[model samples]
Target: MHLFELTCTAYFKNDLDFRRSFETISHFITYAMMRGGLDERHTKSGYKHYVFGGLLPLEADKVYKKGSTYRFILRSPDEEFLTALSTALRQNIDHPDFIVVETHLNRRKSFFITELYSATPVIVTSEGNLFWTMEKNGDIMQLQRQLHDNLEKKYQSFYGEEIKAPQNFIQMIEIKNRVPQNIEIHKEGKKIRFFGNKFRIVPNEDEMSQKLAFTALACGLGEKNSYGGGFCLAGGMR
Candidate 1:
């Protein structure tokens, strides 16, 4: 099933910037979902979004690119839709997080991804629990820094190597939020770049959108149902 059903509903707080609020959204959510499963009938400015596979839906979303793009705006919720939304979120966590466009941030009449935010899924296990983050941009950056510092502390406490830049982190909690700020294709034509964060692209000739959407789904990107089933709160990234 498409991760989000239209029944989802969600809220957007005014960001650190006072002029506007995070875009409102509603959609169904599926975790660790693979995009090759969905339908890619939709196209964004000539890109395939959702395409159909046998029984599953191929993913349609991808990290936003500056020129080639797939963009949608999150609109405010009206009364009736808002009420029905409360029941929807409990069905799953996908309805709560989204990499939606914000108007004020874009500072334009049309949509642009001026902001990137998500409410990702978390499964607590013995290794350590993981959680989604909703932080002011600065805070998120700081938390990333702390992760590096904590790594250093651990190394120093045990290993004796001199401190250096942290190693690349393995990608988890996929976010095809913003399109890559840069791109490069290799021998097999696989490409990689950044959305709100860094990512790699798999190659596919037949269905371009399908390829991108699959990338998004694999990375756990897209809109969520607003019913609030999987709402996550991080320990402040900053």
Candidate 2:
């Protein structure tokens, strides 16, 4: 098992609103995965220890590729899930965000990125996390702006246009022992706020979205969706 410790850096207001918004983003991932016809499952240990999401038990001998564009080899998973994820990613209208079967942690950067896909349009990276289908190649940083706008709109829809997130809750991680702390989690109006900065918030729904992503991961569902950060999912999980 991996050892994780919370990095106390950022802050959130309260647990109520934090939980609400956090859950919202996670559900979107669940919807996308269901649209791909897959399920996720997981078991929880304490508040931080989650078993079997990205790291699962599967065969490693399987080999596959997508023309000269990509080569995929599985260390654990079989063929079906990879196929679904590949198809979903390659079929992107805006830059498609696909994932590799085996994910490696960049110890140097203290972050993780997927294995390479060939013939990739070589679009420059951005801050937000947006991209295009071969031709569009929009920057992710710009997408972050878009996500922020969409989130604000979403919040306004329910909380009124006057609803603005408090400055205290910044989407960033404070890593100590490779674990993040002070995560800003939200579910509806009630949010889960923290005082430390162990958690890093990538631009997106963040806490909630990651939960849903973890939800999909647990269910073994694969599809195209904007994903950020390592997270845990327990909703509708088995």
Candidate 3:
């Protein structure tokens, strides 16, 4: 599958907190999609052709400072979709709260091996409840399995074909430096809270493993990705 990455730098006129940044940016994306002529039905469908990482400060711990620039990354499997998004952003360049100062887009080639790291906390669900990766007795093995399964499902749903991975693909995942966090989000006028885990994951260095990692980056690794829950970067950090 093909993928295009868009890195955006937004400058805020007022202080912004990290907790609310994702939600606000997500709203902006939806608005952009609408403005770009994507109907609500297609945008709200089961498959999301795009996944986005969180807004990170250009300088550490400066996310809440006014005039500080923050960066967000968006990945999509469709070049036309990204082009529409870019046009929409340019149309709204003069927004009062924040302005899109710079945007960089790059088309990513296929990789045979890669590392995947969480850009935002990933949310996995278990038994109708939210599951964070680093919970007490949380079974990292199960987490990896579910992550792979979800990625495969999303890839198939979006691209109309199943992704091939090794039989023990989950076994190849190595979790490193996991940090658990609780987050609350307002969606569709409802306030929902859940715990998520942010961590670094290294996939085995093999062709099949690399394809799996690329799938994860294309489709996001866990649940609620369109709502800012499962965004990840191919490398360890931006």
Candidate 4:
């Protein structure tokens, strides 16, 4: 499979509380997509087939400085969509909160990925319930099953192929922050809330395993990906 990455550098126009900035970033992306004549994709139903990360310069204070350049990433297996997004972001250079100063796009083969890290929290859900911790689920095995199943479904949906008998694709490395992070977004005049956890993940050193990791990195790990949940970073590829 093929994957595309877009990195955006912007100058913050105001002091933004990074802790609660996902909503703002989501809107910014939607607006850019709309401006790029992707109104249907911006408003259409079902999976958006793309994912995004939060603003860069990870800070403890959770506040961003005004006029400082910060970076964020967006990835997808759809190159056409990403190309339009890049063009739209570049054309609409100014915004009330930030200015899109630069954007870089790179395409890569999915198999080139050697490492995958969740740059944003991954929201895994089962039977309309959010899976935040193992304690809530009663065991780690159940959580692992849910995570793998979720990724497997996403992989099938994205590629239109089912993975045959295989080992676990995503190997949990570490949960950087154990606490659940809350993501609230305004949709249709109502506020929707979701909880997720940020963690690092690697593959099982097999081709199929890496393909699954790349699916998560390219598309997203769990639900609400268009809102930036499950955004991850793939490394060790040149």
Ordered from best to worst TM-score, the candidate numbers read 4, 3, 2, 1
How do all models score by TM-score? 0.18, 0.23, 0.84, 0.86
Residues 1-238, model 4: lDDT tens digits: 8889999998888988875578878888888887789999878766788988888877678897887888988889999999888889888556788878789999977566666777777787755475566446545555566667777777787778998528777556666775777678777998878877776766677777777777888888777888889888777655
Better of 1 and 4 by TM-score: 4
Candidate 4 steric clashes = 0
**lDDT by residue for model 1 over 1-238, one digit each (tens)?**
0122122122322211111011122112212122222212111232222111110111243222222212222111122222233233333343333332211111111111212223332111111332223322334434343433443433333234545542312122333445322212122555422113332222122332232222233122321211121121112112
- Model 4's alpha-carbon lDDT is 0.78
**Winner by lDDT between candidate 4 and candidate 2:** 4
What's the TM for model 4? 0.86
Clashing pairs in 4: none
Off by over 4 Å in 4: 112-115, 171-173, 188-191, 235-238
Residues 128-198, candidate 3, lDDT per residue (tens digit)? 57565555646767777777777777767767876777653544454454566645678688987666777
Model 2 agreement with the true structure over 17-119: per-residue lDDT tens digits: 3223323323433343455554442122211111122211112432222221222211111234444433432332221222222222111111221111111
The better-scoring model by lDDT among 1 and 3 is 3
Please list the Cα RMSD from the true structure of every candidate, rounded to 1 decimal place: 20.4, 19.5, 3.1, 2.5
State residue 116's C-alpha deviation in candidate 1, in Å. Answer: 15
Candidate 3 deviant stretches above 4 angstroms: 58-62, 93-96, 174-179, 188-190, 205-207, 235-238
